[model samples]
Target: MAAFLEAVPARIRTLGAYQPGKSIRQAEQESGVSCIKLASNENPYGPSPLAVAAMQRELAGVNFYPDQDSLDLRAALATYAGVQPEQVLPTAGSSDLILLLLRLLLGPGSNAVGGDLSFFLYRIMTKSVGGTLKQVPMVNHAYDLDAIAAAIDHNTRVVLLANPNNPTGTLFTADEFERFLDKVPARVVVALDEAYSDYAEEFAVRRNVVWSRAFDYVRQGRNVLVLRTFSKAHGLAAVRCGWGAGPAELIGMLAKLRTLFSVSSVAQAAALAALGDLEHIHKSAIANAEGEAALSHALAEAGYPGVPTWGNFIFVETGEPALEVAAKLEKQGVIVRPMKAWGAPTAIRVSIGTSAQNELFLTAFRKVMPAH
Candidate 1:
């Protein structure tokens, strides 16, 4: 019998698919309760009011196709990113951009240097192309820039770093990045995935260390790309709109590879509207910071002090198996994420939910793990 699975590439066949946190609907079905989703690092506040209005208005045009070139959205994004329209490419969330970058850079005999503890998408995307993923171990849940620099060799074509990295929520400061950038070869493209950077602050703090810094390097023709999205701070996760800024030539190449009309018209409209509503983003940031602090305080009192987080999530150490602990919380309608997929079986990464959601999760934690 002919089998499609048998024909799959050896590398992809062996690789496990990327695992997202359990969806709210899926959790509700299992527990027969309204589940509080603290699994995926989603904004609890939801999308901006203006974005909602824009998407609603755009629904009438759904029968027609989206703007294939996405010119208007690109122009708006360029203004927001402080770059020229030719240098920014809108994508279907940052993940899409990540896949596109991986598709372009990786092929036979090519490899990328990345941290083992950073975003797992890099691992999946690299191997899907049969390219080697050189994973450098992290130090203190942050990118060990020195280790990443050391890992790059002759075959290294790309270096993937997660700014304010996921699962751990650690950050690589601007100064640390400049030092690392100095060490990287000119030929290697450094892909900085800064999806959570928006939550790190109010979109700007001109310290020469920012997504704009990478944008500056891009304009200078350096091989660099900064990946980000509306999903995090803007509360537009379901819209799936994201973007990247880089050299015009590089942006041209990515634009070429991007599927026609891949980003929906509604998403583009929503993103444009959301960009104008910075106040909503600021409120969401404040809520996330407060929720994270509350969670951290509870954990510290329980003797499980979590590592510092710059993003809207915290990594909590459970003295027992994290998966089991997460399961216990799930039974109580609390859905937090276990870190096994990120290589830490004894830790869980809980997204900062609303005040009520966080309290529910904290109460469930007390019932499940009970302090000593």
Candidate 2:
């Protein structure tokens, strides 16, 4: 068994596991206070009422296996995205879809390009499939699409762009995205991850969905794959439903490689119902917008400045060790993600929470970081 396991490729042996934000349960066990987790950027408002009802309805059918094709959910998503059913493939979550894309496109000798400050999962997934990974440094906390395109080489097969990027909570403009797409070679696939796209607001414009532009580009023969999640907007993170949209052929190939019953029956029903709950989505958006402002103002008052966020989180530079600050915050029952993992040592990313939770974290932060 040892010899067999050791036969694994050197690249696989050297891989580091992806680090997700610590759970509230872990924080509660450590801090002794029921933790107010502002980590992971999950929807604080939770799943829509309709989604809960749908899940409850499916509870009696737990013994039945889920649909291997997730046909109903895919059809519902196609309706929501205004794309053909063939263009959409629903997975357990967007993360699974991303992994499937990498697996389908990447292999030994092929390289992948991704923003250094974007979702860390992109790097992990690309490397896991033996793809050489190139990291493009972000400009002003936003994904530098030019840098990403420039890094692409002949061997590059995929480019992963996480919009409204995690940890940093920044985004690329439409013009910049178009320029990047134009520069990318036809042989390579461009994956646009819109996990938090629902919360993204345009510069000087109101918040609205922008994924249609991505899909339109794909429809025009571009090798673009767009990913979205029910996690953030629909508050179905626990349910784990997400999908990808692109050419039918590309989606078909990915679908073939995906495991059977990737999404549970309950999850599919919950996602379908959540898609129709426009009111809940609106409430979550409003909560996130207000929470972002509140957190930013609180950070400023505490003498730490925060990055402008279009998602349900803010990245703030604390002028101190992020790990230490995070530890301090954790002790106070406010769990946040430190940016050290992303090589931003002086920054800590805080997920926007309810007003009460925000005030609690602010008070705790002030106490831990009193004026010298």
lDDT of 2 by residue, 1-372 (tens): 488988898878888888788898988898887778887888888889999999999999989999988888889888877788999999989999999999998999898898777787887788889987788888888877777888999899989888778878887777678878999999988898888877884321464534236777756767999999999889999898999999899999999998888799999999999999989988888778888878888788778878888888898888889899988899988998988877798788888888998898888888887553
lDDT of 2 at 21: 85
Question: In candidate 1, how many clashes are counted?
Answer: 0
lDDT, candidates in the order shown? 0.85, 0.85
Clashing pairs in 2: none
Q: Candidate 1: TM-score?
A: 0.95
Could you tell me which 10 consecutive residues in candidate 2 have the lowest summed lDDT? 203-212
- The positional error of residue 316 in candidate 1, measured at the CA in angstroms, is 1.1
Which parts of model 1 have CA positions greater than 4 angstroms off?
202-212
